[model samples]
Target: MAFLLFLLCLILVIFTVTTMGVPNIPSLDPVNRFLKGQTDVSKIVSSDFQEFFYDQTLDHFNYRPESYTTFQQRYYINYKWWGGASNNAPIFAYLGAESPIDDALWSIGFLPENAPRFNALLVYMEHRFYGQSNPVGSMEAPNMVDAMEKSLENPDTRGYFNSAQALADYAELLLYLKNQLQAHNSPIIVIGGSYGGMLASWFRLKYPHIALGALASSAPILYFENLTPPDGYYSVVTQDFKEASQNCYTTIKQSWDVIDQLATTPSGLAYLSQKFQTCSPLSNADELKNYLKSVYSNAAQYDAPPNYPTARICQGIDGASDATDILDRIFAGVVAYMPGMSCYVTSPEVVSPSESVSQTSIGWEWQTCSELLIPLGITSEDSMFQSLPYDANVFIDNCVRSFGVGPRPHWVTTYYGGQDIKLILSKFGSNIIFSNGLRDPYSIGGVLENISENIVAIKTTEGSHCLDILSSGEADPEWLVKQRKDEANIIDRWFAEYYRNFRLL
Candidate 1:
């Protein structure tokens, strides 16, 4: 699994528990409350925004040409007519990530900013099996166990939720939109960040005719074998903290030792539970370690504009009295992040038998188990934390137990042409902008250099994962402001070329 994507699931799970106020149930309708009409959507999005539900084929790759399952895929559209409404206006579409589409629309300001400039109708397409889009059934379930069982009970349904299939869904939706708006000549520009970025780039590869180009920000497309080193992800995480405050990094490493030493005795475990204010008792020492790792990983991954939580966390560590107190403050910060919520899960059964597991982990776990499976773990030398081997067998065992399917680790690389990716892009890809931040842990697994005249890569200095595409105003760092501007310029150029080529034809 891409550690960054895993962390996002973790964050969303916590967000749902703390803020969303969603009751535990077999199925949930997260969008109906917000989906009334254009007038209602205007309150959630901008005044011109309109919420929609388009029926999409459940399995785009289904061999049977005549029959298929269909679900009403949720999407939002804003035809603001920035440069006057016309069939020729391009479409700026967001390929939603593992998170909710509405969240992404609200959080990512770049899309809204650039849509008008391109004379584009803005669209945010929710990924199937996530957010309001549910293929097999509703997203909410009685529990994780039930969800897993139901997801894999029908092997055919399990086959439908992958990157390749999702790209096809995007293409189908684009065609549907073209027909609905009578904009067959309108060009489309796909935009995404993180896993969404990966989809955007792949969409260009698989369906270039549908999408003129893609703005893929901080996309870790090269995380597969023969493309990136296994240790690269965690090493970058360590560097982010070390850059902020080396003393804080050393303290975190030392605190792991303290945590391990304390976990040996029941009294020590009780003390930890009391100090950290864990939702449950400290039963599994390894789970505690995983929770701690997530703290650092989350801080580092989201260490960007608005509030630099990573820097604040490091400052807290530096300002603490001693090593033990340092650990206490760090845990306190985690608790503070989710105030008045029992967000941490103690049991192994619910959380996929690993510290990295979450309530939403099963959905992502199945994908990693089926494809896009990448090994990422902590180590003593490569990372600032204590050594912990990435147990591939454990992941396989859990996958088998949960989904009755084991991971095909090389499937993504094999299917997508791993190391030959550069060549693939050069020969076939164009009008794609791959943007990455130097501070981002996942940047190494992305396109850091320009591959060709059209397939461009923009690396940001002092920027975190997908920072350039995230919501930013005057408060953003100087570098990020400039990076966003550069990205916009490149996207404009791609649209220009697309129009030029279209006119020529």
Candidate 2:
């Protein structure tokens, strides 16, 4: 009884709710997600891009008087590697996603590293309602926790935060920059990873006049419209652990039932909670399951080389002695991520599907409820997660209840033409590069084959989200090194073609 009493006290005293904590922040892409709340922006080994603001239309499609209100949109530009408009050096625009543009400036290693070679002007535009570009008066204030919660909860402020509005912002921004710099002849290559990658590809498709090509990394554009199998995402995650060790995979697969069984009684719940070092004693099994799912999802997303997360987790699980229970071994895996968390935060703040990826989950949650409806589930025994079917009713109910907004399920596929993507893009698309790594859960929905001569697809068996865009070093696997080289060569050809055509004129 004394030991149990001690454990309960430890749970209460050890953790306080950290709204901006590492686990609570959500991200649009794996790169941002992996580095969320963890990286010091100034200390990151990245080149600088000067910050600027532009007056942006509140609602590009709405002509109402209220819609004409202008907001200060934040953006960044770098001229260090720019070859002058007279020489026609290309321009590279990286569209920001759900997170602050500041995160991308330091994390996206591709643009700065390759800029000098292409003599490119680097630009990054912040998405509306995120970071300093927000229409909310206090969006950039130090007290962002309260500001984000209030803004995200109000649907009125979120009404204009959709893809079409954002794309138009980029379209106008790019043209304005071109005019300002007098680089009309310069070919524009829009580069993006993850959600931004989708924007880059869609930008090329919708507004070909603006950008010459797109380099989309790990962009699961096909995740919508039943274009890819529903089980694809979970399958890859299960496969990652299974590949790491069958014992690890089987242990995870069994731990769910064990958790459920344990939560059935008070003593059992207390024991479970004390064992896992929960922020509070377990009342039910929901929070525990949610935390595990997040850990697995993120581990699979950013499973890069040099002490990969999955390996670290599997080592903890598989290394346990026979005297230890399966739950202890599983808790060991959790400890791999929360090495110092005496009381794990299993609240919705940390493990809620939406909040798990962003510092503020409101904008992204709305986006998912609005248009980015990519349904993922784990049904087959092939996966380590629970048998949750992709039920639209459940998802819709959850979205409407949470955000007072409902999702447009079929809208994206109907608009984007995903039914026969190869044929659709083959005839119309050119110079776009779709880079996918099969290990990435999102890559199952990615373009993995060449659609046409110039509409290229680059795949690597050993890569994950934005591997090609990550900073290169001697420690990089040969496949990744070659992937970036090939991407550079392809971009070089694009510039050569543009310069050659301009010279003819």
Candidate 3:
């Protein structure tokens, strides 16, 4: 009884010390500063382009406009004329996604490569609630915690962060830039990849007056439930590997069973930890499975030609009898995504886990919890993994816990008209290009066919997601090079038509 009492007291002391103490304030990390209410924009600088902020309205839908807040949204521009921004020139703008605007500008291929041909001004706009554009206002104000607490505590401020509001920001920013440059006639071509791609398409659909056209690559505009194939994402992942090597796919599919068995015993779990080089022991079956599955899904998504992971993954999996050897080879192949990272840690808390390759910004998570919920599940029937059905209830429960609000389940589909998306887009004019790679899982939900002469889908063989939009090189595939050339020609025609009609109007 005495020994038991002393043990209990010791456990209590450790728990109290760890949990009840004053919360350790995070150090001066960039991400931590953003989260901890440090919104000083002076420190966030970029050498590639001049950064500016536009004072944007909080809500465009509200008729009583006096009852809202306005905040500065960060954007970047590079004006060193490519071919010289002569009188009749176009503006190449990227409708930034849930990421830093500068990063997107530097990484995308089309704008840098083709902007010079049209003497276009390069502009990149950061999305709301992301990067330096927190809509609730500056975090660097005095009494930082109180300001953050007040914003969170307020009811009106909580629900203003959504896609519709973001499009309005883009429209306002577009007019601001055009007026500032004194080039109202210049045709504006908006470019984006992934979620940004979705925005690019929707922007052309909603506000065609401001945006002349859009280049939306890997944009899964039809990914909502009752619209896309339930197994589309995972099945495409399996197909990428199966095309690489059937034996590899078979080995990968069977390995999940082995992992499940290994998770059952202490010795087995320890072995998996050592073999996979996981930072810690496996905590549960689901976490281990998810980490394992992400390895293949990421490889499929980024599998461009020449340097992509298909050849490498197959080379590792072929004729490999030992399960440990197979896993090691697979892990080694996928680590190409993370260059400096040493070991694979399943815990998301780690700086760069294997799953971090697929991780998005914190703002994206909030958006998913608030409105955007695209379900990704895996099953042996659909992909090269054990059966794991997606549970919509699990998603709702998680969102409820995370955001303290339930998902507006069908708001996106209802507002946008999901099933009627193709028909709705048909009513619009041309200047919208939907580019997708066959290997890309998202392609399954994207626009794959030509709607009209103006609106068209350009499909690439053996191409991964958004390859047309990424940074290009001499090493790029012949198909991609041809595709970029075709896209540029289309844009040139669009600009010509826009200027021709503008003169008449």
* Among all candidates shown, the one with the greatest TM-score: 2
Which regions of candidate 3 deviate over 4 angstroms?
Answer: 1-48, 63-67, 82-86, 136-158, 319-340, 349-359, 379-382
Q: Give the root-mean-square deviation of each candidate in angstroms.
A: 7.1, 6.8, 11.1
Q: Which model is ahead, 1 or 2, in terms of lDDT? A: 2
Clashes of each: 3, 8, 0
For each candidate, what is the lDDT? 0.67, 0.75, 0.65
Residue 256's lDDT within candidate 2 is 94
Q: Report lDDT (Cα) of residue 240, candidate 3.
A: 91
Candidate 3 lDDT, 1-505, residue by residue in tens: 3222111111000000011111111110101111111111223223658889998888888866653668878988877663333475788888877655644654565787787788888888987765667665555533323333444445466567778888889999998888887777778899887778888888887888888899988888787777875567888889998988888787777777777787798787777777767767756555555655555665666666664556566765563446466566555544433334556645633323322211123344556666676665554474787665666677677667656777776877877655776676677556799999888777888889998888999998777677787666666668989999988988989988887897898
Q: By TM-score, rank the candidates, best first.
A: 2, 1, 3
Worst 10 residues of 1 by lDDT: 26-35
Top candidate when judged by lDDT against the true structure: 2
TM-score of each: 0.85, 0.90, 0.83
How do the residues 1-505 of candidate 2 rate in per-residue lDDT, one tens digit apiece? Answer: 3222111111100011222211221244636342222222333534556889999988888778989888888999999899989988899899888767776776677898899899999998988877777776563456444555656766777788888889999999999989998988889999988888988899999889999989998888898756877778888989989888899999999899998888887588788878888876656676677667777767776777655667878988887746368999998887774465446646655532123434335566678778888877667877898887677777777778778878899988776667798898888888889998877788888999999999899998878778787555556778888999999999899888877887898
Residue pairs in collision within model 1: 1-374, 26-140, 26-141
Give the Å error, residue 272, model 1.
Answer: 1.2
lDDT of 1 at 186: 85
At residue 151, give the lDDT of candidate 3. Answer: 46
Clashes counted in candidate 1 amount to 3
